[model samples]
Target: MARLPSGTAIELYESLDSTSLEAKRRAERGVAEPRWIVALAQTAGYGRRGRQWEQSIGDFAGTLLFAPEGASDNLGQLSFIVALALAQSLDEYLHEDQIRLKWPNDVMLNGAKCAGILLENLGQYLAIGIGVNLVNAPKGLAYPTTRLLDFIKDVPTPDSFCARLDHHFWALYRIWRQAGFGEIKERWLERAIGIGTEITVRLPNETLSGIFEGLDDSGALILRSDLGKRMITAGEVFFGPQP
Candidate 1:
């Protein structure tokens, strides 16, 4: 029950295939900007790169739809903004330093992925989907996974965490809109993992191995390989010695 921006609309559902899909539907129907869609259970949830996202009964599955306005040029930066906000909310229940934000938008807790974020562009609008494993984290994933309840005895419900996330999201969003990515980049790097380490980035058609340099001004990952410096805009990253 936290305060949202003016003209913001909220839609709650007990179940949905995916909140991001619902938000896209609303955008197609010409719903106004700044709408939030939340679902207690998602039957067909998904994450970035079209990977399946498992939604526990009480986990948080929500999407925020908003007009790009003048931000279309640098819209991709919002993923980092959202990640920072989500990390801040989780920091309330978990140790702030324990939370690490992976490149792009994955939130890692104690080296395991605890949450994921997806951004979908819907023409006139954009939908940002957020999934947090509050009570349960699915097992047998490619990478290590974790749940909030594993560390915190008194875990926060989906809605309560969403409220806190909403507050932090808007606060960071406002700063991004006014001050630009300079501050956001600085803040994100503060919590970033694998800054100067050997890593591999799996692209759609090719794989790149390099030293994880850092992030470029536009948020692209800077990879320093024997060939030279390369800026990666999209790819899956793996830290440590590549297999």
Candidate 2:
């Protein structure tokens, strides 16, 4: 791969159960800041709520580790920060502004999920994990799925894509660190999927349906329900047909 941005290091793994797990382990073991682990294939990838990520034969999977100074308690904001970076990177290659974020860390395009992010905290460090549907997508998923080749005119190689993403991620991370979550929140809201729309949130014990208000500074989903405005920190969101 070409030279990546400063402060970012890349680690390639032929196969791993989960890049996020590996990165977290390294972070706990005192790995340096801004380390990234890219896996060509993941035998046991996982998504939010421990759901299987469904990595097929050919797909792009990776985890980016960042030991931001004084960021041990800001893991929640970091998750959105990384999602914003991925959305910005995808915007460069696609013409349509269809990239939108689903709550904490899923990226959707035209109502179909094209990518997802998983963040794991390692006390001193944070792992920003990402799994994108590149060459091939899984079968029989609950929702529609997409890949880069479907939107980009000329698809880039996996290495080239990773390099571009690394550059974008670093740029966004810098902005986030300097300006706080205000700017990131605004940008994220711009590409948010169901803001001001109606959606169903699936929680652990019960499901709630409400209007998708927006996200707070700390990256919680602001919902307007029959009871009142509720800040949801974790849940699965589904944009209803009527919004």
Candidate 3:
């Protein structure tokens, strides 16, 4: 696409099981640099914790594959970077303050989830999958969902949005490569929702309640509980009292 930023190549498809899946296949074969896999619609998209990400025509869903040039431990930190990039893309259509990032990878708009991210470790390359609700919001989801057009009159097409998202992602990727996760952590915390606020995190085995202290340098969620402080590497977080 003409709008795609330089130094990047895109493999556009009308449909796919999942862009992330395609990216993973390519990563297995090997890639010289980061490349994007874009699909107009995904037949089997998924999110963090293996949740299904429903596909719609007007939404943006794409994945980028690239070798991990920095510390291997920082791979999880890409989720924060991807979240920030998605927030920037949303900023183009709505006011900045209206968008808040939920820990791990959900982008909240006006108190509802508008975008989600999924990161996969492919050994040689990292697969970054991002989904933005532009026109169609999945109904009957476990949590509240929203669309970009809900708050804005005009919304860009999936391809157009991916172009913008690519720009933001590349910018942040460069910064992280040159510097580190410190600046990314700072930016992510700025937009992070519910810091210092009490919340509940549901792990696979058990649920924990604690104050959302913030993220550690390595991108783990730091939760302060009655017992002590716990660094959560992965879990489902909900603000306010849980049902």
Off by over 4 Å in 2: 1-3, 241-243
Candidate 1 on 63-96: residue-level lDDT in tens? Answer: 9898865558698999999999999999898789
Best by lDDT: 3
Model 2 scores worst on lDDT over the 10 consecutive residues at: 1-10
Q: For residues 55-104, what per-residue lDDT tens digits would candidate 3 score against the true structure?
A: 89878889988887887887899999999999998888888999999998
RMSD in angstroms, all models?
Answer: 1.7, 2.3, 1.4
Candidate 2, residues 109-195, lDDT tens digits: the string is 777888898887767677777888876666798788888767665766555667878887777777887888899889889888878
Error of 1 at 9 (Å): 2.8
Tell me how many residue pairs clash in candidate 2.
1
lDDT of 3: 0.89
> What are the TM-scores, per candidate, against the unseen true structure?
0.96, 0.91, 0.96
Q: Which residue pairs in candidate 3 collide?
A: none
Pairs that clash in candidate 2 = 198-243
